[model samples]
Target: MPELIAPTVRLHAAWLEAHAEWGPGFHEDGFGLIPADEVESAAGFAAWVARLGDESDPAKAAKAGGAACTYRWIVEGERVLGGIALRHGSGEFVQWAGHIGYGIRPSARRRGVATWALGRMLDEARVLGMDQVLLVCAADNLASVKTIERHGGVLEGIRNTKLGPARRYWIKIDLPIT
Candidate 1:
């Protein structure tokens, strides 16, 4: 079984193993990783992890003038499977990037990891009082399209983004019946 947990430096080596599996680039969508983030060294990885936590802090987000985001890694025991992020703000960035982003390691694909992690994040979104969430993926990515649709995502259309054509979807969060 997979579990969703906050980013931690204790999984440094495990994360690198997952990172390497994706090859070179800042394409680990759910990790909030930027090209400038130095995650190769222990100190750097720790700092990056700290920054991820800070991004989740409303106070820090207010100070930074950016969206508050929650990041979680999908893991089974000590092995990192993938990552998922739920953005808690609506703006141009969120509109273009969507409220959620995720990526599974190449080796871990087709095992329902993305589906499971996305469901977990939607639960988190519900807890945060989000009525609905947006998710955008490459139009060519049938796997992601299916995953979004499986979670009750409604098509919002495809648009040409800076990253290219993307299929945008919105999933409504069903509040619990009292």
Candidate 2:
């Protein structure tokens, strides 16, 4: 269990960057975690996202206080199945989104990666003065809702975002530490 590092992708790019078995899957079931876990795409998208979350990206880093604040979810040693991005500002985060967003690769789905990843991010948030956190997901995303609940998330309300029906789950950081 490694600490979820902010923009934690590049740290483990040795596999994600060079490997062919695990790359971005457009219509194919590359990793089997996204579609297997019921996510959109589960290939190297996680890795690409990690790169976008990089503090060195310059463009993305400028708006989000550098990628050093993003979090990466790594499991099974060298594999980075998913990650969460944390932004500290009055931007797209505070309104519809929250402090973090996450995804797990297709190959690593249904194995409690979502639960552990969210848990890892929560720990990071608490350490960063975030007494409470907000997590938004589509109303139809039952799997995501369940994962959020596993970490003690309480439902705030449902919002009809432009994308679709969304649910806002709140997690209190003040609760007794587990």
Candidate 3:
């Protein structure tokens, strides 16, 4: 596998925490697992169980979608090293979470895993009819700042959210559907 686009998966806690590197971020808000399938154990299933829901509202549905998200980030073969989930714009999510969220294991941090994974998610957003998308990260998160920047994200300014302070960005996804 050349150092380019990898695969993503949706996972459970057992699979997430199984690797010592994932730690706390896997279960937080705007949180997700990379190599997404790392969460396949019975414990993982239990953690994910609380998030599954069928909602009528798009916003509500989007929240459920984020919890139920099963996409993975794959590097090389048979590796579900990371994943991303889409949070629909609604209430606080609109002002904060953006249309996508992602994570890669600590072991894989500077390998461009986030940049690669987010690019794929952006492509998916384009497929979903989103022309431009908003992404936010903590003002102190230099890693995410670089990842988003490498993916053509434009800085929009900073804002304080219920979650914390964040630097917001926008990406004009120009993918045309074939």
TM-score per model over all chains? 0.98, 0.65, 0.68
In order, the Cα lDDT scores of the candidates are: 0.95, 0.60, 0.59
- The whole-model C-alpha lDDT of candidate 2 against the native structure comes to 0.60
- lDDT tens digits, residues 91-170, model 1? 88899999999999999999999999999999999998899999999999999999999999999899998888999999
- List runs of model 1 lying over 4 Å from the truth: none
Tell how far residue 79 is off in model 1, in angstroms: 0.8
lDDT of 2 by residue, 96-172 (tens): 76556666666667888778778877876777677888888889988889998998889999999987898998888
Write the number of the candidate with greater lDDT, choosing between 2 and 3: 2
The best candidate by lDDT is 1
Best model per TM-score: 1
Instruction: Estimate candidate 1's alpha-carbon lDDT, on a 0 to 1 scale.
Output: 0.95
Worst 10 residues of 1 by lDDT: 58-67
Tens digits of lDDT, candidate 3, 5-89: 3222243333345344655434432344324423456655544433322221355556555322323334444443555655544
Candidate 3: where are CA atoms >4 Å away?
2-14, 17-19, 24-76, 89-91, 175-178
